[model samples]
Target chain A: MTEEGKQAVAKARAILENYKGKKLRIMEVCGTHTHAIFKAGLRQLMPENVELISGPGCPVCVTPADFIDEAVWLATEKNAVITTFGDLVRVPGSEMSLAGARSEGADIVPVYTPIDAVEYAKTHPDREVVFLSVGFETTTPSACLAVQRAEKAGLKNFSILTANKTMDEAYRALKDSVDAYIYPGHVCAIVGTRLTEELTGEGISGVVAGFTPSELVTAAATLVELCSKSDEPFFRNCYPRVVTRDGSTAAKKLVEKYMEPADAVWRGLGIIPKSGMVLRDEYAAFDARKKFSVPSFKAKNPPGCRCGEILQGKCKPTDCPLFGKTCTPEHPVGACMVSQEGTCAAYYQYGGVV
Target chain B: MCVGLPAKVVSIKDGMALVDASGAKREVSAELLDELDPGDYVMVHAGIAIAKITDDDASEAASVMGEL
Candidate 1:
């Protein structure tokens, strides 16, 4: 570390350690930030008055049960191959998870990227390929690109089941819950500071934070300093190199041209209007919902799981009776335990920071 | 799936950039970024290069911390 970096850490530590203001509830909206904080043992440097809460930033954790059921339906009923990021395979749907469906003769392929799924569809013309697209702004552009790639290649076997969501409305829904937010850095890198600036006008204050230890400490300390100095809401971009004022214009244009905002279901927060993104009418042929005519099944959370409350900052992971007892990561009973970014999984893995 | 990996672009051809993240190399879509070069660093998400990034995140944070 540079001398200036050392001084910055010292200053940030002093600010957090000497905090004497009213109990401030600052929520880290990104699951990666929650894990990074625990990995860095950052909670040990803070005063008791400063509390860090986890919000619904993990895409896998916030994905509703019905969406998984829809994927399972495509895999079983339509006999289509379900291509997804590895985490979703274990997440329990209405009847069974994709893993469970796989055991019963359903083909489920886990790939690192949506383009790989498009490639699979290209090679296997006889099998229909449906990629389970679930993420915030950071991963949506890649899915859009995959759709365009499939179209360009004249691959008619490719389709996507989108659970893509926007973070702006979610921030608004969670605005009154905390004093301020620790915004996800990558999301801001794509969407820009304009969203945060708009939130500031509406009295929602926060700092866009990167995943590094130094960046996290600086952002947290900056939040404490700014919040302590004023009663008015403020916005700060700690991750400036990646997140600019306009963000990635090409990425934004790709999503806007291909997808539209629609009402979507969240596990904990329920349905927030226009929070979800679906393929535009022109691209509906690549949509899994239209291609397979997948029917919706009623979704239910496992009994005694407090993932809903934990996601909204109403409770901590330890508050759930099954957090570590029955809901170990090996035998996860809820989506929160199934995802590495999930609050319950982070708390369980790091033995609870607070 | 939301984590962004910082990698150096080893090569670029036909809207695809071959990136190296600590000796592990893969091809990521460069369609979203313009004016990207072979040596520029980028933030890769899933299979796409979202933004051109600084070579060092810590030093960048240090400079911003000076203002804080």
Candidate 2:
């Protein structure tokens, strides 16, 4: 380790220790931050008075079961080819996951990017290709580009199931209990910290940070400093190299070109107002939900899973009776266990950093 | 999952850059990020280069990460 790096960690720890007697709740709204916190052992290393909780950060974890059921409907009943990111394959729905459904002859392909799915749609015009678009600001541009590409190619067969969410909407949903937030850097990479800044307006300290171990630890300490030391809340940009105060203008423009804000349901958080993005009326030709008769059904979490409470930070993953027992990563019973970024998976994989 | 990775730019052509992320090369859109070069590092998400990191920031974060 470099001398500076050692000094940085030491300094952060020293600052963190100063607030030993005060109680604080620091929530990270990004799944990557949750994994990074566990990977760096920051949550355990913090003062016991400082409690760290994972929010509805994992897009896959937060995507409601009914959405999955709708996706299953399109893939199986409609004989459509479903292309999704690697994370969604194992997220179990009411009856089965996309992976399990694939085993039953449903055509589901996992692609690294939506462009791959767009390309697949181009080649196979006989079958309907539905890309399960699930992500935050970071992945929204790619989905937009996919629609733009599909439009340019005049491909009527290409469509998308968009479950894209905005962090600000989700933040407002849980702002009352949160003292501080470690903002997702990738989301800020495109949308910046403006929404996070608004959290500060409401007396919540928010810090945008990178994925590195020291960066997360440092950001956590900064949040502690902001909330414990100051009466005023503010947004701190700890990751200046990649994150700017105003993020990529082009990405936001593309989103406006292709998508419009809409109400969407989260797995645990329920339907947040204007939390999701839907294909704009102009790009309505590429709307998967409209093209298919995907039924609107009320989704429920697995009977014993407390993923809702876990997402809202009301309870920890271990609080769930099935967390490690019946809901191992290999056989997850809840949405929280489906993705590596999910808090349950993070806890299970990283030996309980919380 | 929002798993963005730091990747080095390998080549640029037609508004897209081929990046080497952890020894694996993949094509990423260079639309949002600016001033790209072969050695420059970027955070790649969903086949797009969302942000670019200067060498100084890269080495600083690396040194701090090295001890852990």
Fnat of each prediction? 0.55, 0.48
Model 1 C-alpha lDDT per residue in residues A214-293, reported as the tens digit of each score: 88898899999999999999999888878888888999998998999999888877889999999998998999998778
Docking class for candidate 1: medium
Number of the top-ranking candidate, with TM-score as the measure: 1
lDDT of 2 by residue, A1-354 (tens): 566766776777777776665688889889988888777777666887889999898988988888889899998889999999988998888888999899999999999899999999999999999999989989989999888889889998999998998878788778776777788888998988776777776766788878887778777777787777666877888777788878888899999989999998888777899999999887777998888857787765568889888999999888899989999899988888889889999888886334
- Superposed model 1: Cα runs more than 4 Å off: A352-354
Compared with the true structure, the alpha-carbon lDDT of candidate 2 equals 0.83
Worst 10 residues of 2 chain A by lDDT: A1-10
Error in Å for residue B4 of model 1? 1.3
Residue B13 C-alpha lDDT in model 1? 96
Off by over 4 Å in 2: A352-354, B55-68
Interface RMSD of 1: 1.6
